[model samples]
Target: VDGNNVIRKIPCMQLLPIILFLIACLYQGERLDHRSCEALEVILKSLHFDFINLQATQLEENGASSLLDMILYYESTTHLDISDNSGMGTSGWRALAHLIKQSVCLSRLDVYNIPMVGYPALSLSKALLTSRLTVLHLHNAQLSGMPIYTLVAALKVNKALRELHLTNNQLNSYQDALQLGDLLQYNSTLKTLELSNNALADAGNMFVFTKLPLNICQSH
Candidate 1:
């Protein structure tokens, strides 16, 4: 569902308030150099149908905080994309955690290609552990690899999460790989797990060995 399209459908008489709100918030951060929040709020308000796309839009900590505020303020959202946001570093992930811990509505978050996420990966991991998520993607994002455990733990309890993607990440040490295998044994909700294009060696290969579906796992 395109909320933007629906927002366009409302009669001019009924949509004036929303328009005003958008104008007020869309660039609200321009002054403080942090307009992502107000703009995000506008986006949320516009989506009356289902699904919202915020993918790779360069949202920073300020915008992420605002998104979190709205999520908590409204008891969570269904879809969100935070990938490639140059501003969302360690601090931003922590802010997101605060909101995720409170509400379980966020089912998808794409934070790929973020160079500054290594330190904050733990914060995101913690959020996933306690919160409810269904889809998680962190492709090619810089990370300390600490969050992998949090991810492992979350996979066990995250009944809603069905897909996880961390392709090209640096999570391929022996211990980490083995730990992931252990976690997968208990993870019944996930249907797709992507750990490709990483530093997987023989140890890592053995971790997912026969467990991975033949369709998804190939080659040596």
Candidate 2:
């Protein structure tokens, strides 16, 4: 049960040993449930693809870690989805951020239905600072308030970012969207933005994000 030793031994290992263990002291062989996922991990690792959609909400948290490691570390995936999980709380988001910090192949991410509560902003801001992410999806995720400064900083260097989706989240106000407009005014990387079903109704138009190249001061 030495966690450190296990981690140290594996230490970002790629190929998982496809083992058919006996839990009830009965050898099940390929009848084991995890074998399918392990086989998938091996296949993905061998192909060297850059994306995987982990939309299966039922994957256990521990198993998710292994699958994430396989895709991120071995396959160098730049895009991932861990959407619609029952137990995927803030801790999962933090773990994804940890992986993002270490991930060089990852550039875009979609975390569905998770609560942000400032962590997404913080994590993504950090990720954008160190990584080459170009797209992000936080649909239906719980996020309160507009992270103006973080978004500002993120937009400055996030050259790869071309689209942003914040649908069905709590953004508090339009200031950040407007600030995002200002950012788009100077930073031409982003072209499409979706803030639908958010708290963006305040002293502005949706056209602002679309008309970023023109005068932000133009009457709406």
Candidate 3:
């Protein structure tokens, strides 16, 4: 969905006085400054939207943390797309992890194109254990090494997630595939798994495909 079009469609009366400024900054592709973040926090407290898209808004660690903090107060948001915010780092991911664990309505999250390497991955992995998220997108999220392994470990026990996308994350290692295979064996709730563009070899693929159960609707 085009975020700008959605913003334009909203009735002006429903928006607070600061909403116009927020919209103008977003339309200009301006990085949200401290003042803007504060204004956005205020706007979010009163206005509720099921889906919120802040993709590529240049939300560095502080901005990301502030936005996620504001979102904690609004439980009506069900789907959140914060993908492509390259500047988000460990702090941002940490805040997101907290949000995932606390949110009552958030069921779908798109972190596509964000770098979730190192400790950030660990933070998110821990959150997944308790998160109510059903659909998660992590395409190109730098989940190559221990990150993939950690994520797989979490999914093994996570019963809430139903759809997972892990495409283009360089998950070709035999151990990584083994971990994922184990996840599939234990996780009965997952219905779809998308692993396109990864270099999982025949040996690695075997560990995944052979473990698929009839309940699993798709794996590609």
Candidate 4:
């Protein structure tokens, strides 16, 4: 079938249309790009709310494009699970940044195993600047070096995030933990922090707890 006909069959599942379009294009051996994603964006306004779970499949750039469009254009979706999918790339991360820039309605973001580096890291950092995410999980996704620093900087200004899981992401140095500790000193909204199996020194771990806010509920 042609692209127009495939687009016509797209349902109200938000990003699902983009995935279908992508499949049709691939079956016909055509390249996919942002233009199709833009077309799918036109139908997003009709969706009231969404709780999509694309964790089972290997989400590729097309899926990321669609997801990013949903994040950028729609405000009704509250829960999105993109865990265990290693198909997203730099472009996808960049798209996610746009969503973060435009929306503050996302409460939970699970981006586990989607490795990000370079500009994409910068974009996610930018999202943290204004994102209303209450539970943010970036487990073992190579978020070291500058990305960690950027996240720490955003935490200083972010007031809505409650749970931050940086489990097993190679956060080994004491200074890194100290930097996070410094942010927690000023951030009272965050309650639980999971930093297990990292390279945290005993003293650094001690400092993190000492610097934690008085109202913290848990930190594992």
lDDT of 2 by residue, 1-220 (tens): 6434443465344223421121112122222123444545535544554555566435555545555556656744667766665354455555566777677677778877765557656766776655566677778766544555575676677667666777876554455556656666666666566767766665445635474664223222
Better of 3 and 4 by lDDT: 3
Candidate 1 per-residue lDDT over residues 153-180, each given as its tens digit? 6666666667888788777757567656
**Which candidate, 2 or 3, would have the higher TM-score against the true structure?**
3
lDDT of 4: 0.69
Evaluate all candidate structures by whole-model CA lDDT and list the values in order.
0.63, 0.58, 0.81, 0.69
lDDT of 4 by residue, 22-141 (tens): 445532423334454455454455454456444535546766767577755677467666667665676677767777666767678777776656776678888888887888888877
When 1 and 4 are scored with lDDT, the better candidate is 4
List the candidates' TM-scores in order.
0.70, 0.64, 0.86, 0.74
- Give the CA lDDT, 0 to 100, for residue 177 in model 1: 78
Model 1 scores a TM of 0.70
Ten contiguous residues minimizing lDDT sum, candidate 3 = 27-36
Give the C-alpha lDDT of model 1: 0.63
Q: Comparing 1 and 3 by lDDT, which wins?
A: 3
**Candidate 2, which ten residues in sequence have the lowest lDDT sum?**
19-28
lDDT of candidate model 2 versus the reference? 0.58
